[model samples]
Target: MSVYTQLTNDQFATFCQSFGVSFVRAIPITQGIKNSNWFIQTTDDVDGAYSYVLTLFEERPPADIEKMAVILNQLDGKLPVAAPLSVIESNSVQTDDDDKRYVIHYEDKAITLVPCLAGSHPEQTTQAMCHDIGAALAMLHETLQALQPAEQYGVPLYPWADVRDREMQFMPGDEAKLMSDIWRSYTELPLTTLPNGLCHLDMFADNTLWNLQKGEEHLTGLLDFTEVSVEHYVMDIAITINDFCTTWGMAEQGESVNFDRSKMAAFLQGYESKRALGLDEKRALPVMLAKAAVIFWLLRLNVIHYNRTEGRTGDNIMVKNPDLMKRLAAYHWAHVEKSQNTVFVLSGTTSDNQIIGVFSSITQAEQAREKLSNSSEFAIKEYTLDQLS
Candidate 1:
């Protein structure tokens, strides 16, 4: 059975008391791909008065948890992120009636508490925000290039290039092949050289939060470091762009939504502002984006889809928007090809077919390139159609 489970009011209150906090109420927060989270209110009366977010770490071991926390704490000082908080002098959230560690025992499982961060997740991406996110990611990659950790945590045992290799073991045949091919092509593209760092491997839209004040939203908090790993920084960027920038008709219809390119630019601008990309990185952006798409595609196929086939409720979002998983995979393939050609034909004007191959619309691609040229902060050297092969 899947690991997600809910804590009753009594269990929540008792858990709070053990942590030297008085609980007033508790509400169910969204369950992530790995952990089940809850927002607990406390009588502490502090500005960010919430006690903490409760996460049940079912799949990850204690050592993995410790490593993730340590890596994130190191990165938090340098980036805009909310790292995990360790429970001092205790192995569990509470001791049970049978003298078992409630949080550590099978019933509570690998439960943990993290300080709540104040912010809302961005429903849509903007160019400015994308820039900030890009810059932050670049800076993170640069910083991570230097630091070496005591131990490697959550490194993929199998080749990440093929999603099928991993999922086929659990799911059999052509269905698996389709999933794997989509992921392999998207993730395995050669783009910017890989630089090692403590990467937040799971940087989806919901995991990142935006602080709102006076009706304006700014990037504030990044959450859920459970999938934290030692990997390439570009991987994170690819994942964010693939998930947030692309529009899935099925997913949108189910959730009631539309696409916003301005938001995409906002995030990219934010990321680029902090850590400027070289020609290599820029040229490789689409391939990287494809790699990111494949990771989430597999995540949905393996975890979310697997659950639904077995008749489960833990992943309502995936279950509700089944078509999204397929649409995302298709979109990534289309964009990766476009980005690769665009980078190749940078110096001279490109033919309509070549431009179309890389970008969904030639006009939109041209506009994007033009915008990059006009922006004093971010300037891209022009490429003509004739020069592109």
Candidate 2:
């Protein structure tokens, strides 16, 4: 997380009083990458010591950031979301106009205070936790699908075309070629009939909070709504699975990246429990996974460029390793190359289709086939994947 704009304790205290809040302390939050965040402590006569998260919109348009309040308001009681708080204005009283949003002008930058969500990011996610996260995302999408016409969320999908070009100049030959191939595969893929709606396009592990009880972990909350926009539900699922199911191994310590099959299984199980994936979505998932990896790889490369060009360091910059995204893209593309990547589905003429598994290798497919051989009404078939020519 980066704090581009600095605020003194006195400045914070005065700002707190505008909402009838007395400041106690502020601690910089170093987990976020796109925006500045601070953990705020406050006290008042009615409520004793309380905590909140103070945020400054760095890259997002202020108007879009303000619209987040509306989205959060929609999700307040429905999900484990930390909605923005309204600050009192004019003689310490709050009204409709005065409380349009929690956002305020701080040094000419947009800032908002939201309740600090419970739980913390899990260092390593388990299959069960992945399941919980999957269910939560399904609920998030289902709830948002009602808000129609794409105008509700004023944000657009990341301009991958423009970003890919800008960052490719700095990339090496192999990396650049890989990026170009993935971009071509992504843009040429058919997405016209995919289920589209408002989606949290970035569902990285760090953005989710979890509570470990006894021996199992439960997904308690979600963060970072800045990237929410209208997109394909399948694409949203791909973004999340790439982050939650993949194990970077000791990669942070210079090892290898691996995707966990069991974790992916559990995640898909939970997601289907809420909303089952259609045939077209299942067919598109593998390529979508690769595309998701490509998007983040390029975006993080851009983030590195921004941080370095401005001579930014420390809490003023939050940069993720674009290399990991590269490795992830490579891994998924290798599977795509193996050909006919799709989830397990029964396609016999006399029976209802049910997705039972997803794999890249034929041996795994054979094993699944053997298991289903006992049932005469079930048959395994290659998915009719529409890859870009």
Candidate 3:
């Protein structure tokens, strides 16, 4: 939502008139990183004033943008999504032959107008907010289940997969290996059997709006559907949890990162209130959390890389620190390990039926027992985590 492209007032007024309204003014919205966004004000005889968000497709292809617009239209009344306003007449390549939904062509790019939603971006998150977001996310997925896979909609699946190899070329060996290891763990999961649907892969706090003016705060809108994709339900849940449950700090300040268990519980409970999660999804949450962190780490690095290589330096260009995500990935992995390490002890006749070793995961404990020479008499003694839960 940066002002990458500058447009004259007259040019904007002409565009506004195409929608049958007179443009009052336009203000650049410089909060996001991907596209050029503006808060546009228009007026008509019937309505004195009205506001809308104008977005120019900066990086995404025109085809993908159209699909996103259609998706928003489909989800508008159900969710607080900003559905694109249809053009009165076809001005550009028609998005659909039977439908009047169209995007204006501007310099070989697409532009869209959507209603400016109420409320402001929340500065901080609470358990109530997390709960509300979780229920909303579940509703989104459930509603999207009727649509076909992302490929049918011309949307990419697992967007980060396209840039992983290229981004690794620029990463340090340690960071690259960390990324690969976590990614490998995620791929090894039973993803094919897990529940599948379109996911709001980016559900950060700022991407949502809340009615802070009222005594009771509630979510009023969900913004930025650019990162939507077809993926496992657990992966989406993990991505949302990574942002909502984690406490972040400025990378320059070297503050510590922490995850709030209570917030996570509330989010899960809220999600369960709408739709129950499968056992496989429950088991995959820990590693999926780590995987989600890696994706964002890669995204931040990609943004920084392009900003330097493409000479896109400006106050309007918002570049987040990649180090914070790197630290977050490490924290998630450690948390997974800590949760997995339930002190599994291997006993076998080879060691006179005594304890042989302690392991974190069940697979690691089984592998250790297989390595023993006299494995037939071996038995694995697992410690119960009755207190932790």
Candidate 4:
């Protein structure tokens, strides 16, 4: 009952044949959000055996497919991540007899077949993993900064920001109002200025695969670059912190969870190990984290929730609660308040003073009205005023 289109076994075999991969067997891998994925096993006549992941992009536009491919191509060597192989030359993917192209389908969705990464995702986030993730992110951010802006691929540091704004407009009642208020708070905050580059916007825990060979979890590869865009480094940092440090559900339940400040520090340490964040970038972490929370909330509300309402259900996906949006806002605000020094407030001296003065005047006026109400002449004057006026 997944909303995404599924490729039949025969059609999948033909698709693999087109890419010179003679498929022996194919099994669906149910671990993605926006696409239907399958692990296709191919007989390697000379090499022995191999498997590749066929990602049938459901509900994704061709423009997004091309944009991700182009960005991934640019980021291939820069970070430890997976990039889709080009079936046809010049960033265009091929299709089977069913008219399914490598990155586009007849159903107006994008599809791509990627080499299956040979690592398992860690069940829990550890300090070592956090450090590696931090370093990986930092390295990725550095690489992105070195590259040119990819406006075609929608590469703003806060790409989801735009999406959230659109979704808030359509949501109902208090939910929509709360979303709007959080978005306004983010907009009002001064943003960090950093060099723009390609960003892997969806680097959550599930997207990361780990290799635990040496009794220590090492980051094997980063997966799912569908949300790749051009954005600031802090935005990525904010997302990492929100995903790894703040969310309790991500950690083992009933473990007496504490916000691993050391893990947080380790992540920052790794990031700085590659390229140092500027003063503005470091300062903007709390606001960026708040923005990240709001962004994820809206994404769940609009994309996941809407899909569920349309009857899309699967092993890996579920509709997010609307109430969680308020909780997320509160969490972000608490963090932002604690880290206010890092946040850039956009109010000027004159504007700030005027606001304070207005509040003071309102307080004084309320006190004067209360004093007048307690006086005996107050009722007489009110009656006289009513008669005269």
TM-score each candidate.
0.71, 0.84, 0.82, 0.72
TM-score for model 3? Answer: 0.82
Over the full model, what C-alpha lDDT does candidate 3 score relative to the true structure?
Answer: 0.78
User: Which pairs of residues have clashing backbones in candidate 3?
Assistant: none
In model 1, what is the error at residue 315, expressed in angstroms?
9.3
List where candidate 2 sits over 4 angstroms from the true fold. Answer: 44-50, 91-99, 250-252, 340-389
Give the Cα-based TM-score of candidate 1 against the true structure: 0.71
Please list all clashing residue pairs in model 2, or write none if there are none: 344-357
Point out where model 4 deviates above 4 Å: 1-3, 45-50, 88-106, 153-181, 192-194, 250-258, 314-317, 320-328, 338-389
Predicted structure with the largest TM-score when compared to the true one: 2
lDDT of 3 at 359: 59
| Local lDDT at 221 for model 4 | 77
Per-residue lDDT over 169-242 for candidate 4, one digit per residue giving the tens place of the 0 to 100 score:
77678767656666677677565345556677778787888887756678777888777776666777777766
Report lDDT (Cα) of residue 226, candidate 4: 71
Model 2 lDDT at residue 97? 44
Give the Cα lDDT of each candidate: 0.56, 0.76, 0.78, 0.61
RMSD of each: 7.0, 5.6, 9.3, 14.4
lDDT of 3 by residue, 1-389 (tens): 67788899998887776655568888889987788988887764234334788888787777777888777877778989888777766456546644765577789888888888988887667788878899999988888776675556536764677678988887789888888888898888888889877888889887898898645888899998877777788888988988888877655657557777667767877787798888788778879989989988888878877888888977889877777788888877776666565666777756467887865544345545655677667777767566653
Score residue 192 of candidate 2 by CA lDDT: 90
